[model samples]
Target chain A: MTLYSFIFYILAAVILLSTGWAITRRNLVHAVIYLVISFFGSAMLFYLMGAPLLAALEVIIYAGAIMILFLFIIMMLRVEGIEERLFPLKQWLPAMGLGFISFQVCIFLLISAGSEEPLKAAMAEPAIFGHFLFRQHWLSIEIVSMLLLIALIGVLHLGMEKKRKESGE
Target chain B: MIVPYSHVIFLAGILFLMGMFCTVTRRNLMMMVLGLEIMLNAAAIAFIGAALRHGHMDGHAMVIFIIAVAAAEVSIGLALIVCIYRKTGTIDAGCIEGDVCEL
Candidate 1:
């Protein structure tokens, strides 16, 4: 056991625990808070991976920007304080069973993959990552941007339709 | 007692499983979305763990892309939830089921 492993375990524990809390909590706001904790843990994990840039971006983009938006919508829509019904066991039981089985399968596959030679060796220069992203995956970058654009348009359409209905149009 | 990269992967797997559990079990729409975010973040952690294990930057790059997608997903999802709230007046999963806005 090394110091790095110790730190990794602690962070991983925080992430997993927060994820469980985020899922099980009945209160929507509490779930969101747990999600923020989970995000923080992931960010720390990213930092441990030797990608400080990715770690910062994870915190800033996911935890800071995206989650704030989610919270804002929850607040503006007044959904946070509302009481929700208890979980419906009939529907969830089957889903839970299936999810567990699939998850186990995935874990098995990942473990098998890990036993193979690891991917590329650790590079001394991180900037090579940036170069590869730009040179090889530029199309993926563009596609993601396009997807965001479409999502934005979808949101606007939904908003407009809601307003139209409200105005009795 | 330090753990190793493999332990990190195991921990991330547990977290991912927990997040999936929330996604499956939660009835509140907002909570479901929160669960989805957690699940996605768990995947991100796994990516980072692999990157550290291999000492490569590709995994980090992948994490960046995943974060970008998560942001886009949340923004769009929140917007839809807002619309769902306006029409149904509730964020419960059952309420939105038969409502005109099927999200």
Candidate 2:
């Protein structure tokens, strides 16, 4: 009814439609591009929700970095121009079933979680967000750092093994 | 109230379901990974929405960690996909289960 509500609905429609199209698209590259647009929609939704810091992060990390990584991998695999590989109705059965069930569950959760009233949007600015991360959630930060380190090492090992196998052959 | 908090949850849920649909139906391994990234973003949206509703900074912090973890995951998963392509010569996930092609 209000402007905020109108904008929220528009963004949600953008996200759902783009992502639905992305999933159904047969071209991997095209799908990734569509997904990036959906990510942008979600990022704006984050901004509207008063988490500008999170919104920026969503754009930077999700739409920017992660999408580029997908593109790079798609190129590496050379699965280009494989146009319109539609999943048969049989193949779509499971995704549809699961998606429907999960959506119902989520609605139920929202209803049970109370607060049918709309939220008074509150912004968690970057300064306070950073303070909370360092002061209140310092342990999580350290663990995440360690996890990133491990992932880096694991990826390098995998790449190196591929070279070793090629040379041995 | 401009928009109901529940509206945000519903939106996120829809996005998450879309991601799941992509993951289950995609034949390409890379596409599946992209689906996973979408699902993670949906979670991030929900987290931020909850933070807004609660007047806390925890949601932003959670999103930061989610972003970091998603980056790490995508990097490692893509590297594995490269190895898969090198060994198998195809990115089609069902190529292995076809039983005609020797692993």
Deviation from native of the Cα of residue A89 in model 2, angstroms: 7.0
Q: lDDT by residue for model 1 over A29-119, one digit each (tens)?
A: 7777887888888787666656677777878888788778877776687665445455566786777788788778767766765644422
Which one is best on DockQ? 2
The per-prediction tally of clashing pairs is: 2, 0
TM-score of each: 0.82, 0.89
| Candidate 2 chain A weakest lDDT stretch, 10 residues | A80-89
In the range B1-103, model 1's lDDT, one tens digit per residue, is 2334555566667666776666666667777777677777777777876776666656777777787788778777777778777777887776676755343
Q: How does each model score on lDDT?
A: 0.71, 0.82
lDDT of 1 at B13: 70
Candidate by candidate, in order, the iRMS in Å equals 4.1, 2.3
DockQ of each: 0.46, 0.67
Q: Report the C-alpha lDDT of model 2 over A1-169, residue by residue, as the tens digit.
A: 7788888889989998999888888877888899889999988988888888778878888899889988877776788543335567776777677767887898897778666777776677688778777999899999999999999999999999978877899
